[model samples]
Target: MDKCKVDVAIIGAGTAGMGAYRAARAHTENVVMIEGGPFGTTCARVGCMPSKLLIAAAEAAHDMKHAELFGVYPGDVRIDGKAVMERVRRERDRFVGFVLEAVESFPEKHRLKGHARFLDAHRLQVAENCEVEAGRIIIATGSRPNIPQMLKAAGDRLIVNDDVFSFDDLPDSVAVFGPGVIGLELGQALSRLGVRVRMFGASGGLGAIRDEKIRDYALQVFNEEFPLDPAASVSSVERTEEGVAVTFEDGDRGTVTETFEYLLAATGRRPNVDDLDLQNSDLELDDRGLPLFDRYTLQCGSSHIFMTGDANNDLPLLHEAADEGRIAGENAGRYPEVRAGSRRAPLAIVFTDPQIAVVGMNIQQAHDHCGGCFEVGEVSFEGQGRSRVLGKNKGLLRVYGERGSGLFLGAEMFGPAAEHLAHLLAWSVQNRMTVPDMLGMPYYHPVIEEGLRSALRDLNRRLLMGPESVERCLDCGPGA
Candidate 1:
């Protein structure tokens, strides 16, 4: 095959790969992006974008079922799973079409539609018998659902988040085998869609939030809202006449079996590193199968090659992936003398019902390091007017700061528009804003924006009264 030369060759056309392509093109003219499978990503086809649409449909169905609570009784609500699935497919198709069109229009950017394998340190072989040798390369292959091997006995009955919504009909019951973001979101979404879902995880938690108290409250709310069995762990899965029989080791010497129409193996996700045949290249791999890169520079052993997105073993959210790709591409194109000056830290958002957003250190983290100077505050969603009006009033906003100095170290929230709130917190943490600086920002009234102000008030009070002061107040307090 004839060797094709380029300034940059990015493997994987997902969010990170596309981001690198866009960012690299701004600096250099010769860029090529190779993607295996379809041109679009799970985010466009089935991941975040499509799954959220399905969840919204389920929410609508759930609301209709309990419409009598609002005094406007709208009769019995019936959901046609077929219609719902059709709508979901339509939405996914529409978004996928946009991505396909975008990629097709980039005539200057060579988009190869096949698997990419490393032929050498700087050369890659594409399935189309084409070879690409670039000055710099970026691997942003992203990740896939990490289903547990224990569920493999059920074979066809088992599905992961990547293909969960592709079922011809809604399952009568489902057993989700994890407590991470994907598991929790799918379990909740399916439960809302009228499936009897029982979720199980290694940790007795709802998601990966740092605060144990908040985790407990989240699990409690999830259990109350849906059928959750945090204690259950699947020993094996066997097919039954109805569906799949999931056997769980209940205790030291006992096992319990439950039959479900489907088994969603929502364990977790791992980077898409193995498929790339990195052995042919000089890239190093961490124990978790992620690309080993400098924590700050995101550069592989050779600065000419970089890894971004989930492949980098850092933050795996879409926003963080984009940022990493931008940084990697910019640095790759910049003169070596100037590349060392850039600074960046990642922030992430897990898009569950009550979205989990995080930036910088938690209060405990700050306390462990800068003990006496730490001031923290928590405000509940029950006090937010927008939350009450939206009827999603079950979350809290927490902030950590330095005493008297007011410098914000971190913030977290599990509530409506949490991702949006994370942006504000990220800005504050990145700039090392003081408590007064954050509180001074005038938030609009009667909107979700008030949650930030309410949270800031709690931090202000905590700072005024000192760390030993009671964290909670009633009646006149912001939390109240």
Candidate 2:
């Protein structure tokens, strides 16, 4: 067997792996990256980029259909599924090409083209032929969609994100299982594109927003776009001559069997660590078989091994994976004097019609951490000027803050321009800004930002800040 040694060995060429590779290379040129196939990162190839392409197309179709609201009626409207998929694939390939080029830029010998398994703490066996010895290792193998074994019986009728973008044509109808981020996004997009879509979630929430009010608002908005059953408990899935049959029980509706041309299993994802032969190492495994690693340092129990990205199963978003990868790579290269890394405040967004955003702590987290110490402020978009003008005057925004110090805690909202609002809130939370500080900032008239100001004003009213202090601040000079 061939033998090789490197300063750092990164397994998986996805976003996290690539992030680690770039960082490790800064410390030493003797860095290598290994992957089996499908060189593009997951976000560009399947998760974020391709999904957004479909969503954008669906949004365009929806806008054209709704143009009548503005007294502008364009004649007949038709959608060609084949053309839409082709555009998505064409644009997606461009993004993937960039990643492929970056990977190929590395020396051919440094780019191992095969699966790698752990032989020992500091050793790896690649594809049964080559062996690699590295001073430190970064495992950023990313993740794969987790489909239940029961659904495998459907054969080609079942689809996951990995293969959904490659379809030659759209299905006539689809029943999406698990109304998480992927399920809701695709389900609504397909519905807008004229495909009959139904979504089911075992839990009582849509996407990852746990705030009850925000979830209810999301349900209301999503219900208008497509059928959603959050209380559904899937019982069975079977193949049919024409398509696939699904049996499920809903709290509102009794046991029902529905047939759809295709089934999408967005049931979540599992870290790609099972095939890495982690058992051969001394690192302790969790109940889910993930390595026990420090969140701040991204280092596993073994000093020579580090875990990052989706492989750690902390936050599976692409941006989070990239940040974790940088942390892991930096610490791995700086071994004995490991440095801690600070992560950004929690920020998650679901790109549905009105959009769903959860910045920092949600209601449940705030309640659990602060109990009654936190005050909630809210505003409904029903009467908001900008929202009504744009025909998006439906949904709600809720902001949470400490009652005494008025420190911004977190926020969850379902409203127009929610993505922007979520980022503003996340940035404020990261900087530990207080409610008064936010209110002191300028809020443009007839803009969605006014909704945030209204919520903050409500919070300020409930805060313990004295009236004198409030007045003093209100009358203070601009520089003060």
Candidate 3:
């Protein structure tokens, strides 16, 4: 029954919403953020933080298994799943506290604990029956795990990533139903902790990643090292008294069933758009429930309404979401197209063993956009001086660039510290850095990163002789 007013109203105080609030504060007199859940964002609560904590726990377990190689023979190796969950909870709580404290630091901004649904184009209704009329709205509702409908037949038998971390006990085995980012990361983590992991997917497992070599590296790491089976596909899942029974159509299309204590439906994530009732605001939705927006400014439906992050689906990277939220907030508060357009597209990395990162366009993608004229070069870390020193022998760096222009278009890496290396390549692509220019840049020796420098040298060589004369093009070569 209470009525409130603000200049700007932000829905969902997650990463994108928090970013919008901070950016809008500089331009608006009154900025308020409305959240449905607790103060912490998913990334801080059950998403990034807790998952990484679990991965850290798994890494410890794995290290003990390899202790013999380090000349320290622990009589036997074992993992306490309960203890790992406790650590995950502790770390998650700490991170949540930090986020709650950080959100409180913005004094002029109001934080309300309630979901906000649009009452009209300019009005929003919150929990406790409160209404806030605002000049503009920024929607950053984020996303939820999308378990496939067919697999939902087993009630309470399926668990998503969010609730998986809260389990009091570890499953004896798990059948991961998708090969997306979460599936691979969690599968590898759980597998390392001694869980029998069977990973299944429809096609191009890990569809988000553009580089085939990087995907192969991920598949190899999980299947070979952690003992995960990548080619399994589930035909049905049924709840059993002891656990869950998953029937799969094997790679040869033979029927097989396996029982696991838990099943994680890590297929993908859908945008949180259904609850908003967009008809109240005249917003249009794509077939997949994403908001239709101006790609450049992120303005949706009308000038006063904006969408950011996973809600729009350009690229779901956290940094990209935060940047989009800032842009949306800034543009909504003031004039449209005030700042220079984002010249660079976002890049993504899988946090699995031998992390994979892809920036800009790969050779095939670039060729499709232009012509098949880009020069591709690759260098491996196996024989590189630095990789051998670090005890990581397997890794490769691939670069794609225009022929005569020598402008870098894309770069991908698979190996130790590849996540960090990919960002540099992303920056170079955005800046149009040339092979000769980037190659001359100082690189410290005996570091995994020097692999990038090695790739640059190979690229420079190919650029000098032209694409036709090139041989041993690692990017196009077998196994990269």
User: RMSDs, each prediction?
Assistant: 3.5, 3.6, 3.7
Residues 404-441, model 3: lDDT tens digits: 87777887777778778888888787777877677656
For candidate 2, write residues 1-480 as lDDT tens digits. Answer: 999999899999999998898888888889899897689999999989999999999999998999899998987779999999999999999999998999898888779988999999889998989999999999999899999898887788999987779988877999898889999889899999999998988767688888887888788778887879887778998999979998988666788888999999999999899999999877899998889999889998747889999989899998899899999888887786688888999999999888888999999898887877899988888777677778877878889998777799999988889999999999999999999898888766568777778777777777766441233123221111
Report backbone clashes per prediction. Answer: 4, 0, 0
Candidate 1 lDDT, 230-333, residue by residue in tens:
66766777987888998887666578888998888877777888877787787676676556787456688655888888777577777777777777777666
Per-candidate Cα lDDT values, in order, are 0.76, 0.87, 0.76
lDDT of candidate 3 at residue 88, scale 0 to 100: 90
Prediction 1 TM-score vs. true = 0.89
Model 1, 51: alpha-carbon shift in Å? Answer: 0.9
Clash count in backbone of candidate 3: 0
**What's the CA error at residue 272 for candidate 2, in Å?**
0.3
| Evaluation by TM-score, superior candidate among 1 and 2 | 2
Off by over 4 Å in 1: 249-255, 335-347, 367-373, 383-386, 448-451, 465-480
